[model samples]
Target chain A: MNYNWNWGVLFEEQYLNWLISGFGWTISVALSAWCIAIVIGSLVGVGKTVPNKIVRGICATYVEIFRNVPLLVQMFIWYFAVPEMLPEDWGRWMKRDLPNPEFVTAVVALGLYTASRIAEQVRAGIETVPPGLSAAATAHGLSTAQTYRYVLLPISFRIIVPPLTSEFLTVFKNSSLALTIGLLELTAQSQQIAEYTFQGFEAFTAATVIYVCIALVATILMQVLEKYTRIPGYVGKEA
Target chain B: MTDFDFNVIWSSLPFLWQGLQLSLLLTLLSIIGGIVLGTLLALARLSGIAPLAIVAATYVNLIRSVPLILVIFWFYFLVPLALGRPIGGFYSALIAFVLFEAAYYSEIMRAGIQSVKRGQVHAGQSTGLSYWQIQRYVVLPQAFRNMVPILVTQGIILFQDTSLVFVVSLRDFMTASSIVARTEGRLVEMYLFAALVYFVICFSGSMLVRSLKSRMAT
Candidate 1:
């Protein structure tokens, strides 16, 4: 009951700059990781459905390992453990010569973790597609690759937009974990502001507001994308 | 590369086990607390009262919007200041996890409740049962059964999240591993071992949920 509250400290020049830069890092990390996630996730997802048993097993193992491990642990492994596991010169380069090691390590860790989740979604999306479509594509003399490329992926991607949107939102939120490895994203910046000013409540409130705003905007944008991509008479359309 | 050391892990077994116990304790307590509070929030949202529903919905959405780390920070730093005394890291982290996970648990509970047929409620009504009686004797049993797989899945995620208490310097498993890694200079061995332990527990948990889901479907 005796603590002082100073909301104004958040707007002071130095604090404001920290928040801005922190916000910048958060967005950059999330977006870059998202790009990696979607691309790799889709491929791994498609790999899970391939005819080769070994390929499917490999894909399944990837999803299990990445998805099961905690993101914070994974971050540490990437930042501290993986480098040393590499050959001597490469390990040295990773530890000492890599530019922005913290940032790069964070992006790679977050991306790989999110990729596993997204791969699961993508796999579900593909599996839920009517088997008749694939059968018909083959009946039309389409190669398996052609069938998947031209028929399966487009419909599966549309079917999964809603789940994908939530996962996208999650990546942004999970980007906060970057602070664990020394990347000063929004959450880290807010904590720093709280430390410097002794105004913990105001600092956290500002961070919360910014995060909520980001989620709202992202939700709205994804809704719009969902609307544009709606499949006529699909299950989600009425809902 | 320096020779890998299995001896360090064997030596630190007691410390690691202590940390693992704390992580499981936090996860267990938070899951219980989250489900209890979440069930109430679900009821409030489904209640006919407009303000109650809106407030419940807003709470769920707002909490869902932010990272758990920020909420953990809020409780760790601000709650003590507001209350005029520190509650220490463990309690603050526990409170934060409970509140944060409740938002997610509420949505799951709401879906489970809604999945029950409306006719079931009407059947209870025709039997002259009170609303609370109807919910208690009829709806909730079915809802809980329907939600078991999802609840377990969420519990697994909550277990993973308990490691985030490292931010407050609480000696959970992840933090314990990091501490030993630092002091013993065995970052590679310690962290990889930590990851392997988590993988085994969580991967098996998910496998259990998967079997449960399949059984439900059958």
Candidate 2:
């Protein structure tokens, strides 16, 4: 079978508009969810490593529940099922006050889920440090809080940079599930445009390329960081 | 926040039951299909055949790097267009989940299979078994036993990901809860319940897998 290809369709004004508008929503969702992930994951990751037994248990519970479940299911639970249980006024507030509840719900769910994995990454990073490092900081006039801030966290963050970058990519891809709630992000926009234009392959191909490019750039950046941050023994392992 | 709604729970029982069926069916078929495809891909990679390894690696990296939803949508939207064939919604989704899951499982199996040591293969030669026989009798059985925990872990992941089929309007438990939420107008309650279901399913599956791993170790 023979087929004709239309490269012009991609650069047309209408398709460009869709791409621009869709990217705006996509970036907003990704950034917001990423922020949430950073906050929750940092806290829980530290919590898991804390001396307090209760805090460690709580963090473990959180990680197990969220990390093992699917992002799509979590998004659904946030978008469709959760509001019904809210108090009447609060429920109405969630439905009406949120400018785009779809975006908000997606961010919250995806962020929380990704945060669990990030928590593990953070913990792994922290544990990778020598045990006496924190003690040395404490003995050398660093407070308990200062010990982590000054000595533990900085080194751990550098060490875990590669896995942390992978976590970010995972979160980025997962943000597309927000489309199911009708947020009109990149994936949703492409699908909608494809439906309207009947150029399904073209629209999805663009989406695929964009995703691949973003991931490639992120992976390269991570490798560079790893090289620069090389802690002598760990450098040049060809990850 | 209002108290627990016993009435809603009682009324939604049958709907929840139906959703359970769909979730189970999707989870089982996807895991099985994934295992078959993943084994083939793993074998191809381990074969040390350059082209086959390249193809297998490409498949794993491409799918694993993308979002699961994109894979699902790719199958939903592009299958009929590419093949000129009509497929059912369930099968379309099964295909997507299988393809995605295979990428993960293949990687896991590849690691497990490779760690069997080169000496183990030569040892099989002393017994006079063919290469395929060695794989089936000596390699795969032990590999599969050790492979069970990873398989179980991947299985739990696939079970949870079955919710992605909801994007195409398949009434899985999560979708069913959303429909209930729309009618009831209680977002938090419905969602919390949905999360509860996911937590229970995944947590129990993981616990089972962990115990099985320990049992195997013994």
Candidate 3:
């Protein structure tokens, strides 16, 4: 094992800039996708629990279709086929005029994919809340909507904060798949550095460290959130 | 837009099947390897030996925190040089997946092991069973049975993740489909077909898991 070791190459201005911007993109994409997942997933999740069988069926179907497919394939469909499926002018606009198409496609693909998973979590969280609470709220003359808004969601959200943390970390890790569509996030940037410097070992090692750092910080922050929000008597049970 | 061509895909089935075989091979190999190593790590974490527990915990945490694709790259590039020899992409990716999945499997198995009744171990100890005997005869059988559904779920995830090996230019199903798509200029057809194949397999696999779960519940 006589290969040259050049750990210092990562600090070069060119590689450093790539890593920084890539890191920025990765964080931005993951954060934006997390927002989308939580918002849509919550709605779809609540929809799944509604009494109307049709709404529940539709929401379940959405989760199945999105969750069953591979993220890479979904990304490909979004980046390539989706644009072509639109009307000609809109399709052309998307392909030619849309700003940061790869980033947009990546975010949309990752968001919708993750939303299905989060929807399951959200559904589990909602279902985990005691039935008597909603019953009591109804008995107090609160409408179903108000009961959920004031009573059910608050508690369920607290219960789900831990699993949501895992999903949050997952969104960040899955962002690395965006490189398949040419968004130069951290993984892609590392690959580019490796290609230029022929130092795949160091480049990937650095990227791995960065990912571990970011994920650990997110985990710690989520742990703190979980600890503070944890209902003393209700912790540690699986939903 | 061009008419969708069924003929190209039909004619390419043999090549596609070869790719599928490789994908399955990777999945099967890695699942076995991961479970074997994962059980060891899980045991180490539960072994009540501080250094072993700390080392296992760190390894699992470090592996779990990073994107698996990065691990594939690290193994693909680093291991060969460390061994003072070059290895092929497929072998490197296989090793990478095994090592990466072990962390996740360990976590699942750890939870499963903990779920077993503590009294059962006490009972075995009272019968004069050695510690290793208690684990082997009393704890692990129950734990593994409890974890089968979860292990299957993880296996499904492993199948989906094997697509990531396309990054290494492995001739897995995804890479093969993309190759055909590029050469034949049937990008949409190829990709959509590929997605459908994945969806059908995974969706049915999950359905089976759901039924198995219900059976377990009953």
Candidate 4:
């Protein structure tokens, strides 16, 4: 209440550049991790629903193991423990020679951790598709993969657009955790600004606003996509 | 170096156990606080009052947009200045968790409330119930029942998130483990043990929630 307030310091060149690059890193990490999550999550999700008991069990176990662990702990494992677990030279390479090891580890950690949650959503979306569609596809002589590619996936992806958007936002938010591993992304940059300037309120408030803007834009874009991709006479109409 | 050590964990259990207690305490207090605040937020959003609805929606979206660690830092830094005195890390972290979790809990509660049929409210009103009475007697009971599983799931998330307090140097379970890991040079052992405890607790908690969900379905 008594302290001097200086919001204008954020506009000064030094901190502005830090925040800009920090925002860029946040987006890059989040978007790349999202790509990994969706790819791996869909495969695991399909595996979960497949008739092969062994494959299903493996997928289920993967989801369980990843989902049960905290993302922070998982990041530490990837950054610290996993590198040392490798052979001596490989460990050294990971610890030293790897390009932006913190960034890579963060992407892997956030991606794999989120993939479990995405897998669940993907599984739910796929299962929500009518069974008769798959049955009809098979009757028409289409293979299982073809059925998923043509019939089930098209509909389920449409149905799941809204949830996927939420997950997308989640990935963005979770990117802030990458700071823990020494990636100076948006949240970390904000903290650094606060540390140096003693303007914690201004720094975090700006970061919070940037985060909200990103989430809002993502939400709006996804809503538009959801509107267009919605299956007529189906899910989106009712709810 | 080749051998895994369980002895360090056993030796350090007392210190780690205290941290675990703190984690649980944070989770429990925040659960109660979050649910109460969240219910109000849910009702406010649903109340159709322009200002209240907008405020509730904005609060939920804003909090949900940022990483919770930032919120923890915000409160850690701001609360003391706002109050003209510094507070302890535990209290700061607890306040952050409560406010942050309330945003998520509000969204869940909103969905739960919306899931209750509109006719239920009409029925309550037809029976001479006041507005508050209708909500208390008719809407809330059903919404609470519907939301129990999700609330517990969020509670598990809150437990996991408590680890972020390591940034504030709070001696939560993860912090304690990291401390022991550093001092004792048993990095792998300490971290893995900490992870295992978290995994066991969260895994079992989710299983319980899954069963509760199925039971509700049936």
* lDDT top scorer: 1
Stretch of 10 with least lDDT, candidate 3 chain A: A230-239
**Candidate 4: deviation at residue B158, Å?**
1.3
Query: In model 1, what are the clashing residue pairs, if there are any?
Result: none
lDDT of candidate model 2 versus the reference: 0.81
Which of the CAPRI classes, incorrect, acceptable, medium or high, describes model 3? medium
Candidate 4 per-residue C-alpha lDDT over A75-143 given as tens digits, one digit per residue, 9 for 90 to 100: 888887887677778988998899999899999999999999899998999999989889999999998
- Give the lDDT ranking, best first: 1, 4, 3, 2
List where candidate 3 sits over 4 angstroms from the true fold: A236-239
The pairs that clash in candidate 3 are none
**Per-residue lDDT over B1-218 for candidate 3, one digit per residue giving the tens place of the 0 to 100 score:** 54678788998999999999999999999999999899999999999999999999999999988887778878888789788887788889999999999999999999999999999999999999998899899999999989998999999999999999988889999999999988998888888999989989999989989888999999
**Runs off by more than 4 Å, candidate 1:** none
The fraction of correct interface contacts reproduced by each prediction comes to 0.90, 0.65, 0.69, 0.60
Best-performing candidate as measured by TM-score: 1
Worst 10 residues of 1 chain A by lDDT: A230-239
Model 1 sits at an interface RMSD, in angstroms, of 0.9
**For candidate 2, what is the total of clashing residue pairs?**
13
- Candidate scoring better on DockQ of 2 and 3: 3
Report lDDT per candidate.
Answer: 0.94, 0.81, 0.91, 0.91
| lDDT of each residue in B57-160, candidate 1, tens digit only | 99999999999999999899867876788878888899999999999999999998998899999999999999999889998889999999999999999999
Q: Which segments of candidate 4 are over 4 A away from where they belong?
A: none
What DockQ does model 3 achieve? 0.72
**Model 2 regions lying over 4 Å from their true place:** A1-7, A80-94, A130-143, A234-239, B1-4, B82-85, B184-186, B213-218
